[model samples]
Each structure stands twice: as C-alpha cells, then as structure tokens.
Target chain A: MAKSNKPIVWSLFAGGGMIAAFVLPAMIFITGLAVPMGLLLENALAYDRMLALVGNPIGKLVLFGVIFLSLWHAAHRLRMTLHDLGIRSGRVAMLACYGVAGLASIAAAVVLLSI
Target chain B: MGEVMDRRPYVREMPKSWWLGQRRYTFYMVRELTCLFIGAYALVILVGLFRLSQGPVAYGAFVDALQGPFAIAFHLLALVFALFHTVTWFGLTPKAMPLRLGEKTVPGTAIIVAHYAVWFVVSATLLLVARA
Candidate 1:
C-alpha cells in the first residue's frame, strides 16, 4: 500500500543522473586509454586482473557502495521505464524490474562480503 | 451531397488525453530505456575497473573476452545511449537544481548549454593532448 510520489521518483532519478555524470568522464579516461593500450601497447590495464586494487579498503568500500546504491536506483528507474512503455499493468512490471534489481543488490553484497 | 450518406467527412479529432496515451507512453519508455542503457554502460566500466584492481591475469582475461564481437557491440550501443542520456539528463538538471540569484531564476536551457560548452572544451583538450 505504498503511495506513489513524483518527488521520490525524481530524487532517485537525480541520484542516478549524478552517477551518470560521474561515470562518463571516468569512462572517457579509462576506455580512451584501454582501447589504445589493448590494441597497440598491450597494457595490463586492459585486463581484469588489475582488480587486485579492489582488495584495498577504500576500493572495496567504494565498489560495494556504488554497486548497492546504483542498483537501487536502477530498479526504480527500470520499473518506471516499463510503466512509461505502456505496461499499465503495475504488478507484473514491478515484479520483473524489482526482481532483477534485487538479485543484483544481493550479488553486490556478496562481492562486498568476500572483499 | 447532403442527402448522401458520406461518412468519410465525419472524422473526429483525437482526444486531448491521447497525449498521455499509448504512443506517448512508448516514447517515454524509449527515453528511459536509453538512460538505463547508459547506466548499464557505466556499471560495466566500474566492474571492469574493479576486476582490474584484482590481478593482472584476471584483467587479461577480461580484455580477451572484451575483444569478442558481443562485447564490442555492447560498447557501441552503450556509447550511443550514453550520449543521448547525457543530452536529455542535462536538459533536466536546471529543473532538478534551480539556482536563484537575487530575483531571477536560472533557466534549465542555459544550464544545459553551459554544460555542453564545458564538455566541448574538455573533449577538445583531450584530443589535442592525444594528438601531441
């Protein structure tokens, strides 16, 4: 029986929007290097083994927090996306979007626990 | 002509609420899905970075897998969505975060324009550096 509210939705939207803003510049830095590095120079940064950095406390914290919150934001937006797409049948859409997001959050938690 | 049954000329206009009907709903869904794709692109990057920080061997495996066709296609699609999302998201930012100076409220359009100006400058600098 939760009430639907625009402000709540927008707040989550804005948070996701902020994450989007942060990611683009970062990707430009990463892929901009990874592409050339992987293709031309054969840099190790192109590989996932560099995930050794995640063992660091700061890295672990950031990764877990980002994964958890971003997924939370994603679930809400995905539900809204379905609704906007003319899936006026609320129950089905909610189950799908929320189900996927819930699984993602659980995986994130496991990753954090292992770290 | 009046005595004839001409049903062709009696068409009615669509209802006003049709703006909120199926077509508009589909458009709205597309817009949000575009953003979701953008979000997915970012997550992949974050996950890659995390894996990289783990170990060189693991990172190498990721790079190898990424070279596959599916990975490349996803990247290209994500790039398109990210660009679209950035444009639309910034267009909404001023509405999300309004700035007031004295009596005047800053407009969303101006804010979006300013963001583009900055994005252009930064991208230009990066290109110049890369070229050098």
Candidate 2:
C-alpha cells in the first residue's frame, strides 16, 4: 500500500484548530470590535504601533503561524463539510480546498517577510 | 465462495437532511459551519497585513474599511462564531487528550477548567498588550 499523506494535513488541521480555539476569539474581539468601536485605545492599531509589532521577529512568527495554520485548518474542515453536503468528488474538493490554503499561506509568508 | 460472492450486500441510504434529524446533529453541523467565519476572518487579517506592508496610507484605509457597517456586522457575527468554536473546542479537549497524573488519570472537569483558566489569562494578556 502507498503511504498516505493524511498525517501531514491532519497535523496542520489540528494545530490550526487549537490556535483558532484559543486565541481567535480574543483576537477577533480585539481587532474587530474593541479597537474599531473605541473600546481599546483610540490608536490601538495605529500604523506606527502595528508596524512596530510586525517589525519584531517574534511578532512576525506568531502572525505567520496563526494565519498559516488557521487557513489550513479551515481548508481541511471545509473539504470535509463539502463531502458531508454530498459533494463526493474527493480529488477535486481536496485540490480546491488545500489549493486555496496553500496559496493563502504563501501570500501570508510573503507579506510578513516584506513587512 | 462463488455463491456468496454473487449475493449483494444491502446498503443504507442516508437522507439529504440527515443532519437536521437530531438536535445534536444540527449542532454539529453548526459547529462545522463556524469554519467559514474563521476562514473569512483569517483572510481579512491577511488582507490587513498586506495593506500594512503597502504603507501607512494603505493600512489606514484598511482600518477605515473595517469600521464600515458591513464590516461591523460581519465582525459581530464572526465574533459570536469564534466564541462558539472556543467553547466547543475546550469542551472536546478533555476527550481528545486525557491528562495523566502519575498513577491516576486527571478528571475531565479539571482538564476543562485548566483550559479555561489558560484561555482567560491569554485573552487578558492580549487585551492589555493591544491597549498598551
């Protein structure tokens, strides 16, 4: 039997799920609601501060990991969801789902590096 | 063996709306659906990152766009979904990874409470840092 690549994708999916579960709520609340609604400092996400955050190596790594893993996690979940919804074209679904995640991960890496 | 091979096995057909048949099934579907919001929110952050790299003007515009009515509504919905994911994920963690304390296995409730405590600390730290 050929080796299955399931473990690699599953690891990414699980890691992403872990990150999404733990930090995503607070991250969303902070960036989406609090900052925009003036619940945080008026300049909480000001350009300078944000630039400084992204400029730091550790910050870049964290952002990259969060974005990368979360995308993969969503991609895998969506693929399974599509199957549950009766879209049984497994190969096509796998390509479309993982393809999007792959491209987005590259985009995130490129953007982070440029910053 | 040949006679046995000639016989076809019966297969059960699942209805299209199977998930809707049970409350737990429906909840499970909703839980799965949260990924859409999570994926979307991540993409939004990705876009913001790209804009930030573009410079202050671009980043400011991105931030401005986030405050619009549609953006606000989406974020509000995403926030709720994210919270749901967090709750459900924490609840499942005990089952996913049972902790061992030497000779005895730790109680599931203890594991869940520990997760919540860590989540609280992490969220508080993020808020403080962002506001600082």
Candidate 3:
C-alpha cells in the first residue's frame, strides 16, 4: 500500500464531522427553535451576550474550530460526491474543492481574529 | 475467424435525477446535501461575524433579523440536515477507523457512545461557559 497526504485532510474532515454532528444541531435548535419560539429568555442570544461570547478567547477558538473544520469537511465530502456522481475530472475537482475550503478557512480566521 | 477485438469498457451515464430512483440513493443524496447546508451555515456565521465587526447596531439588527420566520425556517432545515449528516457520518466511524483494544477490536456501539459522550461534555461545557 502506498502512503499519501490524504490522511492529513481526511483526519481534519473526520474531526470536523464529529464536532459538527456533536455541536451544530443543538446550536441550530437553540437559536432556531428555542429562542424564536420564546422557550428561552428574550436576550438569550442578544447582541451583547453573543458579542461577549465571541469576544471570549475560548469562545473565539470554538467558533473558529467549528466553522473552519466544518468547511473542510463539507469541501472534501462535496469533492468525493462529485466523483461519486460520475464527474470524471478528479484533479480539477480536488483543486477546486480544496481551494474553496482553504479560502473559506482563511476568511473564518480573519473574521474571528478581528472580533 | 481470427479477429482483433476493440476493448472499451462501457461507462454508464449518470443522470441528474439518478438518486431519486432508490431509497438508498436518495439517502446518499441527502447525506451529500449536508455539505451544502453546513457550508451555508458557516457562511451565515461569517456574516454574523461581519455584522459584529460593524459594532452593536449592525450586530443587533442581525440578531433581530434572525428572529424572522425565514431565518428560523432555514435554521430548522439546516438543523435536520445536520442531524442526518451527523448520524450517517458517525455510523461510518467503525469502518472509517477501526480501533483495536488489546487483542480485540472495539465495537461499533462503543465508538458511537464515545462520540456522543464527548459531544455532550463539550456542549455542556460551552453552555456553562456562556451562562457564566
């Protein structure tokens, strides 16, 4: 068997998938359902509160981890999906898919750091 | 008769709606779509960050806008899609990276339980942090 650099990206993708699965739905539920439906206090997700959370060093890291890894996970999944769907151009797909994820990661880092 | 035969394997043309024909294929399609939903949610978070960068007024407006029906619906949809994605992706763990425990391999159920356990711990920690 030949070793390839894919393990690096694949590890990230796997980790991202785990975190996204673990954390995202509950997040979406709270913001989407609980807050909007009045299940929680009006200011549960208030701007000040959210800003404070994002402004927290730990919170900022968590936010970055969630967004950045999820992007890579989605990107790699989509690339494999394109191949699965019978798109024959492997090199092109890999380049485009990974390229987008990389750019998005940089953007996420910038946004988090600026905050 | 002796003849030289041309050898070309037939490639089946995949149609746009190929996934619609079967239950499993449809499931696969739905799983594939999680990437789109997750990717979109990440973008939404980025937008939230941008609004935050603009200061309280813009951030407040963004938070207020999130209460709208459309935003709620989109979030709900993304949540379901993310759930599906998580389950299916998690189910692949045993196969993706089989773990060995002493002389025996760890069971799939154990792997899943471990993932969920960590998930709960992390979520709980974050919630507590945010609350405090």
Best by TM-score: 2
Evaluate residue A33 in candidate 3 and report its C-alpha lDDT on the 0 to 100 scale. 64
Q: After superposition, how far is residue A26 of candidate 2 from its true place, in Å?
A: 0.8
**Which stretches of model 3 miss by more than 4 angstroms?**
A1-3, A88-96, B1-18, B124-132
Tell me the tens digit of each residue's lDDT in model 3 across B1-132: 889899999999778678889999988888987998887787788778888888989988887788899998899899889889878877888887789989998988899878778877866765554344
Candidate 3 on A1-115: residue-level lDDT in tens?
8889899999998888887888887777666666667764456677778878888999899888988888888888899888878786999999998888898788878877888
**Candidate 1 lDDT over residue span B1-132, tens digit each:** 558765666678655454366886555555677756654654665556545545667656666666677776777676666566667677777886788889998776788888777766755664443333
- The deviation in Å at residue B41 for candidate 3 is 0.9
Order candidates by lDDT, high to low: 2, 3, 1
Interface RMSD of each: 5.2, 0.8, 2.2
Model 3 TM-score on a 0 to 1 scale? 0.83
For model 2 the TM-score comes to: 0.94
lDDT: which is higher, 1 or 2?
A: 2
TM-score of 1: 0.67
- How much is the lDDT of residue A77 in candidate 3? 88
- Give the clashing residue pairs of candidate 3, or none: none
